[model samples]
Target: MISPRPSLAKRAFDVAASASALLVLSPVLLLAALAIRLESSGPVFYASWRVGAGYRRFRLFKFRTMYPDADQRLKDLAHLNQYAAEADAPEASGEGCAACAALEEGATCSPVLVGDGGEVICEAEHRRRQNAGPAFFKLQDDPRITRVGRFLRNTSIDELPQLVNILLGDMSLVGNRPLPLYEAEQLTADGDGARWMAPAGLTGLWQVTQRGTGEVSPEERIALDNTYAESHGLGFDLRLIAKTVPALFQSENV
Candidate 1:
């Protein structure tokens, strides 16, 4: 278990700060949601269950970035992305909460739009491609992004709904970033599996350190996250949050 977590004052600060952020950012969020629905047919908000504090699971909200059935397609490709972590760490896989993990390979669906009156858009599970022939794994630059999607992601506007997670107490303003179930399990064998000890956050130490850095191996990423957890405190949280400001302007791979 994590030796100890942030102090009550810090935790309270996170709650108050996130709440205030949500209130002030509400207009921006609503506008973004309207843009998403205009260009796509999916819901204004895309909610996925992500690993959270205390190793718990919580639905994370994001502006939809892919085709609606992306979940099913992911399901079909499960073996590869699942065991993709490594060959020997463990021989088991957990069923993803999203249907993407269940869709079979070779299945193809015509491009569909998410909104009624916007740009042409199609949400696909496999649109991770750039110039065809299998898509690239990306922290950013997904080929499937719509014109508006591109703008939203680059500006980090797509993450606005997460303010709800903070309000619900399912997330924090600063902490380790959350992981997909598959990524969580894969990192387990990579030196204590940093995910096991870290609470999912909207921002964290890794976010700041990794800014302007090149492709990071999973090992290095885990190390940064663990270090944050090891020394977390009220002052440290404030420091990291402050650092994240300038880091936000830096172009990160994600």
Candidate 2:
């Protein structure tokens, strides 16, 4: 089982660092907020429900990086989703494997899975179907982003407001990133859920590992998150923070 409470050193560091960042970056925050407001007709800050450690839900704050109608515009841009299923992928027949089908009674697929329509599927097929699409949605050159928003995203200034979440003990300076509600829901399986073992954070292993390599597959992202969850500590977090400094300047928009 994952520990819900972080070590004293980790917690202490998060509190001190987050508070200091918020104080020192206050001017930048205000400027970003003003820029967002001037460019769009919505709240300067956006708060979306995110799942954190132990599957707890909290509102994650960010400088608004999309137009007010961004969510409404999502459906129109489904084709652009970087994680969407490939158009040429073969259809899943949902048929039992030959071995399992031959057994007629008693035995079943060695590793079984339940599907969305309440059907049982073998592991290989289940994995194939799952890998056919990703739970998280992201897009490169998303049309919903404003000019100012694009700058903020490129510089990651939009993520600075999450310092408040860290200050409030809702996150850490380094841990697996919190997931949006929809993303979190799709990650409930044991393999995927392993990511929830760590506290949510402003940045973490996957973000740093995938830096500048715009081709992070969903499975790879989750594997990195699981790695961090299994091994993060005060010293490791410090190392990640140091690496994060240089990563922040990378041109990769996501």
CA shift at 71, candidate 1, in angstroms? 2.9
lDDT of 1 by residue, 95-193 (tens): 211233445653324444443455333333222212112111342444456777777776778777787787777777788877666555445544545
**Least well predicted 10-residue stretch by lDDT in candidate 1:** 127-136
Off by over 4 Å in 2: 86-133
Please provide TM-scores, in order, for all candidate models, with all chains considered together.
0.71, 0.85
Model 1 regions more than 4 Å off: 1-5, 73-140
Could you give candidate 2's per-residue lDDT for residues 1-254 as a string of tens digits?
56756789999999999999999999999899899888879999999999999899999999999989998998798768776643213333344445565666755676878888887777655656665445778888999999999999989999999999999999999999899887888898988888888988899998887888887877788899899988888999999988998898888865
In model 2, which residue pairs have backbone atoms overlapping below 3 Å? Answer: none
Q: What lDDT does model 2 reach?
A: 0.84
lDDT of each: 0.64, 0.84
